[model samples]
Target: MLTALSIRDVVLIEALDLDFNDGLGVLTGETGAGKSILLDALGLALGSRADSGLVRHGTDRARVTASFAPLKAGHAALDLLDEAGIEVEPGEPLVIRREVKRDGGSRGFIADQPASAALLRDVGATLVEIHGQHDERGLLNPRGHRALLDAFGQIDLSSVAQSHGEWRAAETALAEARERLLNDVSEREWLDHSIAEIAALAPEAGEEEALAAARSDMQKGARLVDEMDGVDKLLAGSDGALAQLRAATRRLDRLAAEHPLFAEALAAFDRALIEAGEGEDSLSKAAEALRFDPAELDRIETRLFDLRALARKHRVEADGLAALLEDLTARRAAIDAGEQSLADLESRVARSQSAYRNAAEALHAARVKAAAALDKAVASELAPLKLDAAQFRTAVEPLDQSQWGPHGADRVEFLIATNPGAPFAGLMKIASGGELSRFLLALKVSLAEVGGAGTIIFDEIDRGVGGAVASAIGERLSRLSDSRQLLVVTHSPQVAARGTQHYMIAKTSDGTVARTGVRSLDAGERQEEIARMLSGADITDEARAQAARLMEVV
Candidate 1:
């Protein structure tokens, strides 16, 4: 329910704050008391279109805020709050604020979080509904008829919607499988040849890097072969270092053997010759390791070339060749089993279609039954409001196959005939003025529990009737307030008196700018206000007595 409204510099309303209570609250005053301005301010906070003219004179901007505290956990507005990523704690109120600048720019906020105007409007719709003589939204809109019917009947449409989704998915899968099969069959030979080419190379993950490294080593060895050969010659035989060292050591050995010091010198000469020979043998082994195989190099280069060429043809790097082969092999396997897979997919699609059709039929059946009960319920409400001859019915019609939707295959509409011998037509086409207003009220009462918002404001719903008719409308509005909050703007004293709380919209001036203000009326104050409504501009003693009687109506 809407708990409060705060308006700042909006048209004739300047810095006004009003707190609202639950149940029926009526606003009554003389003509041009700025009641419409108050409604406009509330509408702006609810994300209605903003006009630059709405800003008060000399003010830079206008702001309006509406606060609501839904008593029920499953109130539809709660889902909208979650969707906007706005969290409302256990005791917090949902605050929607709107600002309209003098230059025609506007902004909206949900719980102080900036939001798009469209989202604010959607969130607002779930929280409140304002019904009047020419309403085109909510219950009166034909586009939302099916949803309203489903809500009224408490129908669970998830099964039908889920089955339809599954059916679409299955159909899509079958189509994709067929497309793949057709493509693969047309290119079967090309696929076969490609598979063989990759298998023939038999590439490994790291083969390219290894081959490139080996080629590099071999090429470098070829460049340094001459220097290695010179080292081998210096350690060779005869005139090489090993042979010259051996000849010098032999001449020193015989002189050393004649004395004790000479024997030690001969042992040193023997060790020196042995070291020279070992150096010559190490050189020989180093020369042998430097040997390069040109043919092996050629083979490695050719293999690397083949691997790179295949990778280029397939648009993959050499290392990816292995995985690519696996994928192609899988596609080939799929081709071999394509027919069976296609058949299985077709069977699945058939099953899903059958399931969707069954669910849709069930929904259609449930709506038909609910429609009958709703028509009877609404019919009972019509006569007491002075429309005993009027006929009301909920029409359930089947949609074409192309029009069938997730909700089901039926289109629901509320049709009515306001006179005897008249054919049933849409509610708007046949009814006008008081008849139309009463019909909407009757329909609203029938769907009050299921399809209404938490806070409903009726803009002069008791417009075209008085006396008994006015009392009947007030009684229903009072009854509606039992479940949800209702606010009515009325000229009828009876309707004003039915309200659980009364507010008087009055315009005043401070010798500069005219301002609009609302005051909640107490019991005696409410009686005077109703009396004013009863007697117009003059307060007569008889009007007060009648107003008191009307105040005791509930």
Candidate 2:
């Protein structure tokens, strides 16, 4: 409930502070006395758009602050504050402040924490619903119509909504699975051909390096064989000098006994002959080793080329051919199983669709039953508010199957017929401003216990009708205030007299400027204000007496 409102330098409201209580509080003033200015100040504090024009001519800024006490502990606004890490004093009023400077810069705050105007609007939504001639009635929105129907009907539809959501999720999952399987099936033949082609190559690790080494050895052997044969002919042929050397060494050895120096020469010549023989033997063994076939080199090169060509054709390195083959084989296997898996997914989708249809049908039926009850309740509230000729209705129409949503397969609209001969039309189209106000009043009184807002402000709701109709509107407002705080701006004496608290908004002019001020009126003062509303500027004796009677009756 709104506890207090403070305004500073906002238009004609130079400085004003007002306290409110939990009951019907009416603000009464003459034409152009700044009643609208006060509402605009409250709207600014509630996060409406700010304007530099709102600042008084001599002031640099304008500020409006609204304080509220949550009727319960776990309000949505409190939850938002908790999420933002803003602390609120227990049992203390929550203060929301908005400031607009002359330069068009604006700032908003909640519990002293700097905030955005949008945040204040969101929190203010949970605290108050201000209905006026030009206000956007959130309840009238088509998007909110279903929830409003459910709230008015007092039906718990959350479980049905949850079940419908689950069905939708299951159906979505099944459709995705089937789509994947269909794509896999389309690629099955290609996958199988790739797998077979890669498997035939069967390339092994390190085979390329080993084949290259063998080829190198064979190519070198062909050249070395010819060199070894030339060396052998020189060392071991019939005209070889090693034989002559042997004969010379033998003749030297015979004279060694005559001379000791000659013996040394013979010993050296014999060592030379032995070394030459060992050289011949080593050349023979090397020639045998160098005699490799050239065909062996050709065969090794051919095999190496085959393996490398296969690697290139498959677009992989020689070592990667093995892993490539494994991947293709697995893809082929998955493709082979795609059809069966797709069939299974199709069955699952069918079951999910059935479940969704069943849940939606059940919810639709409940809404039909609930809509009827709501129509009757709203119709019952109309007669006393001078809407005897008006007819209230909850129009529930079935939506197309493809258009079905989480709420249900239905579209709900609040319709009305304002006169006896008129065809029923949407409430927004059929009702005039005063009729809309009365209809809203009836709707609110009907759903008071269901959709809870801490404060409800009605700006001139008692505008068009008078006499008994005014009295009925007052009684309902008073009744609504029993459970929820209500603030009303009224011109009707009956409505003003119904207020447990009355505030008079009056214009006062200083020598230089005119300003607006509000004062909470005592019982005697309230009678005078009511008398003023009843008789205008005149305030006749009979009007005062009637005002007293109306206050007493309310």
Candidate 3:
């Protein structure tokens, strides 16, 4: 229920705060009293498009705030707010505010948190339903019709639908796998050939690197042998320095035994002779190591080249040959098992199609039964609203099974005939604006308890008809209030009298500016307002008596 509305600098409204309550609260006034302005302000707060022209002449911005108290802790609006990342404390009122600047920019807020207009609209939809000349008419929507039928029948088809969805998803996955396997089967011979070729290669890790090293050593071996042979000849030939150094070292040793100066020379000569001998031994080892068989080197180089060429041809690194082999093996296995997998998938798809068909059939049956009852109820309501000749019908057409959707496998539309001998057509296409409003009223009265919670505001529901028809509309509004809050703006005295609370929207002006204001009328004030509505701008004794009578009936 809407608890309060505050408006600041919005067009004719400079500053105002109005509190609302449950039941049929009616706002009545003469033309140009700003009754529509009040509703527009409320709409803006509920996330309607913002207009900079709505701001007062001297004001920089206009703001509207609406507050609602949810009937339960887990209302859908609270959940929507939670999803929007807006916090709402338990037991606290939900406050939604919208502001528009003079520059045509606007901002929305939910629970004091910055919000987008789109999000505000989403949350607003869950809390209030506004019906007007061009606003949302749930009765005309087939989607809403299906929901109403389910709610009326007290059926929980969501779980069935969920199961159907899961089954379909599994079937789809199985079908994709089967398709891949079938494709593999067509290429089975090619897969087998490729797998065999990769398996025969049997490439091992690090073998490529070892072969590369062996090839490099063999390629450089000839030059290294020539250099080592030269070094060996220089260090070990008889004419080489080692023989001469040995004779010199022997002469130095004989002198060292006689004098200290010769002792230093003898020590140095001995160290030089030992160093030369070590160099000769190192050269001999090098020459022996440089010796290699030419055929062996050529064989190693050819093997390395073969491995590299294979890696290039296969579009893989030498080290990745093992992984490639495994992949080819898996492909071959898939080909071998293809027929079995395809059969399994076909069986699963068949099962899923059957399950969905069964569930859809059951739902269709339930809708047929529920629609009959709904049609009868709505027809009964039409008589009192003065549409006795009108016939309300729900046309359920079976759609293709393959086209079945979340709703079901049927296209359900609400059809209506306004007069006898007339063919039924969609209500929106056939009904006039006034007729549509009354028809909506009838349908609402029929499905009063089935729809979800939130405030329902009917703007001038008494547009075309008057007298008894208006009274009936008022009576239904009152009835609707029993389950949910209803706010109506009307010119009918009967409607005004039906309100648990009455308000009058009036235009007042200071010397400089004109402004619109709303005030909750007391009993005496309400009677006068009702009389005014009954007698135009003139309030007569008879009008007051009639207003009193209407009040008595209410």
TM-score per prediction, in order, is 0.82, 0.79, 0.81
TM-score attained by model 1: 0.82
Candidate topping lDDT: 1
Worst 10 residues of 3 by lDDT: 136-145
Candidate structures ordered by TM-score, highest first = 1, 3, 2
Q: Rate the local accuracy (lDDT) of all candidates.
A: 0.87, 0.83, 0.83
For residues 40-84, what per-residue lDDT tens digits would candidate 2 score against the true structure? 999898889988999988999999999987446788898888877
The residue-by-residue lDDT of candidate 1 on 240-347, one tens digit each, is 876777777677776776788877877887897788678768766766776778899899889989999999999999988988888888889899999999999999
Clashing pairs in 2: none
Task: Write down the lDDT that model 1 would get.
Answer: 0.87
Residue ranges of candidate 1 with Cα displaced over 4 Å = 7-16, 55-63, 70-75, 78-90, 99-116, 175-190, 209-297, 315-319, 400-405, 420-425, 428-431, 506-517, 528-543
TM-score: the better of candidates 1 and 3: 1
- Across residues 208-242, which tens digit of lDDT does each residue of candidate 3 receive? 89888887887687889887767666656677678
Q: In candidate 3, residue 186 scores what lDDT?
A: 79
